[model samples]
Target: MHRHRGVAALAAAVVLWASFALTIRGIGASGLTPVDAAFLRFVTPVLLLAPWLPRALRAVRRERPGVVVALCLAGLPHFLLSALGGRLTTAALVGLLLPGSVPLFVAVILAVTRGERVRGRRLIALTAIVLGIAATAVLTTAGATTTGIGVLLAAGFVWAVYTIGLGRTRLDLISVVLVICTPAALVAAVLEVTGALPVNLTSAPVSHLALFVVLQGVGTGIFSTLSYGYAVRRLGSGIPAVIGAISPVLTTVLAVPLFGEPITAGVLVALALVVGGVITYNVKPRDRAGSALAGPPPAAGHRPHVRGLQPHLTTGVVEHPAAAGQLHLQ
Candidate 1:
């Protein structure tokens, strides 16, 4: 039952994430700047989750300073980069590069920081993902588009660091969400009030404002993070990560009609490679003990043990610092 709930939550998160790409790409038509969109994104959750602020603050004091910094980097800064990149390029590319490149960046970070080895299929999958990203970059014609890709790649790297840091922290889902969103919302509010960033929330068309408030504020800001975190807690990181590979395809297909973005052959090839690589990378490998280690597949009602995580048998939820941190929607 818990696993089923996790799958449902993960599916919802994937759709929400695709809509995020669409909304960011459509910010221009809505008469909102990236800053305006980002403000809406950051502030809504902070307000709705206000009750958890004290807990989040307590967690921050206990967490490593670097982990807090990583969470902040993945907040407003990541959103701005993603928004700018979405504006400069197609929504298809925004979907493609942001999530597509994350695993590769995570792998590199792990290798450099921890000297982790990537052997077998995982190495091959990373290589395929890298080639796909390179192909997408090489096929771009416009300078602005190229720059957008670079920015999105940088955003992916920042998010990867956040993913690692999340795994290291012991904060619960609500605390983690508050920790990331509160500071970003405060900073954005100050910027808007001080005339540093443009303010259009009051003057933009009601329809546009409503759309952003619902989609960016409620959907991406709150539900996406909460749902994804819950899904990770129930389902573990591997299944949800593999299932998330569908976002690029879903976003690209939706964009064709919504934004009239053309799907080129090159984009198709790149998407296939990236999606395929992500799936391959998440496949569980056989144990060294061969057939005995392989063992039988879990029964229909059996909950698989998530490697590296301690399960809370009473609650049936996996507790890990990284579970809630696996979110990559930004």
Candidate 2:
């Protein structure tokens, strides 16, 4: 894949992810217990990727023993809290707030722990994202369901922790996800088998259990994990973080149709600010002059290379020559 195509693929992944809020709402609309719904969502992914578990586990043992264990511990709160939040809140709010919260928290954490200072464009971008989120939340407050608003706030905090955890740990994508998910699956299964999960879907007329299979299994499991890995691999985590800025706007816009919610000027303005900030943050000064003269360009993809203590993994379908300074996976 070329650079442009890789970017398009990344965008498509976000769009696919954007669909998840709607799906989750549909499941929750059916009135399933949060635990039951969460159980299905968490376990489906493990089963879908179970075939690859051996390879993922081997990678864990080789490169990230401590990280592998930490994943389980870190993911417990991330999944459980978010799952509960989703069930208690509107899908639209939970989805939008979580992404909006990630960048701000990631910046703070990186600055404190890694000594990575937020500078120049990044600082501005971070500021704009924070302002946009505040604006949207403030404007939407009167209209937001109180329950949804409360749950979304909690969800945002949980997501912030997860985002920081990712930066803190050095682990392969598959291995880390597997480690996190395996334990989550065990806990959920325990709940279900112990009769803590209500199974009244037969009378409820909506089968959220079935819906969880698609939402977590296909959407969160395959699409989310692949998109995340590929995005970070090909473009670096910064690019994805920039692109994720639009997630809040995407969820809000999509919700207009899915939930019959009204779209106001506040949402559009917030989207504009967020998009502008992201562009400013990611664009290099020299690219301005080159961009005008450029015609069609090649797609961008993974060009793995040595970076710090970890071996960089290629993110997308793009491949590069050795001379380009990218390391080929052995």
Candidate 3:
């Protein structure tokens, strides 16, 4: 694994997400709607990745193309649904439910589909994420809605699956973005055409549109998506979730200055927990003092494959296919 590259990817993704949250918060503070913002989300990516469309289309059509294309749907509706749900629900609920539970969703998917067990430190790190996200939610001055809860949860699930798919397969990032964003832009175009989601550039102040293109379009849509894919490509599936879980903290921190949001004791504590969890999650077995030894693996499926992670472990020594080295475990 290109460990450094993964770390860089994870870092870039986390920064983009944090910026995304901050932008969303700013939108919430204004009378401006996110419909146009959502529209821009899809369109920006389409334009940015236009050059790579042909190749990405080829990738999407190849080797489980349907699955890849289906996975592509994850990001398309997230912004729109989340925007609609926000109108129906509280900001706090939206924040807590979506980013907070995404990790659990990913963990379940990996365990059930990939048969990757969440044992030891992974579990501990996950628990910390849960706790941190919960704390952040409690500190948030937002509202609630029965319907909004469902929408946000669905959003969380979509993103989790999206993250998992990125790590699960070896696909070119640009191609995946092309496959995903093209249809997403089309969806937004449909909404605009139907007048279901009105987009009036003239009606909206010029300043708002500028912000939308800069933050929502370029930052969140292009940079965020590419960075996350890169991060997942590097960090694998686990720490990306950890990094994502911490985005709320970044939101809160940035929101304090940008959105005139306050930082409460709960916010401080939540930040601590989130930061701690990220640290813990990134701590590899080699980082710990004689890190708690992992046992052996089962006879099948447990053999160390260098390219990706495997499951059904007995916890003995597993040979790393790429490293061609032994993972010394308990």
Tens digit per residue, CA lDDT, model 3, 90-161: 443344455555555677777897687778886886788678766654554545455555676676666665
User: Per lDDT, what order, best first?
Assistant: 1, 3, 2
Model 3: weakest 10-residue lDDT segment is 313-322
TM-score of candidate 1 versus the correct structure, residues matched by position: 0.85
Clashes in model 1: which pairs? 167-322
Global local distance difference test of model 3: 0.52
**Candidate 3 off by > 4 Å:** 1-14, 28-32, 84-100, 133-151, 224-247, 287-330
Clash totals for all candidate models: 1, 10, 15
Q: Write model 1 residue lDDT over 1-330, tens digit each, in one string.
A: 987897898787778777777887898788887777778877887899898888778867987898778767667877788778888899888787777777788788888988887888878988888998888889989999999999878877777767666556666656766777788788888877786877676678888878887877787776766565566667755566566678788889999999999999889988988878877876556567553212332222212122322111000011111111122221
lDDT of each: 0.69, 0.51, 0.52
After aligning candidate 1 to the native by TM-score, how far in Å is the CA of 38 from where it should be?
Answer: 1.0
The better-scoring model by lDDT among 2 and 3 is 3
Note the residue pairs that clash in candidate 2: 2-299, 2-300, 3-298, 3-299, 3-300, 4-299, 4-300, 230-315, 233-315, 234-315
Instruction: State the local distance difference test value for candidate 2.
Output: 0.51
Candidate 3 lDDT at 130 equals 73
What lDDT is reached at residue 163 by model 2? 38
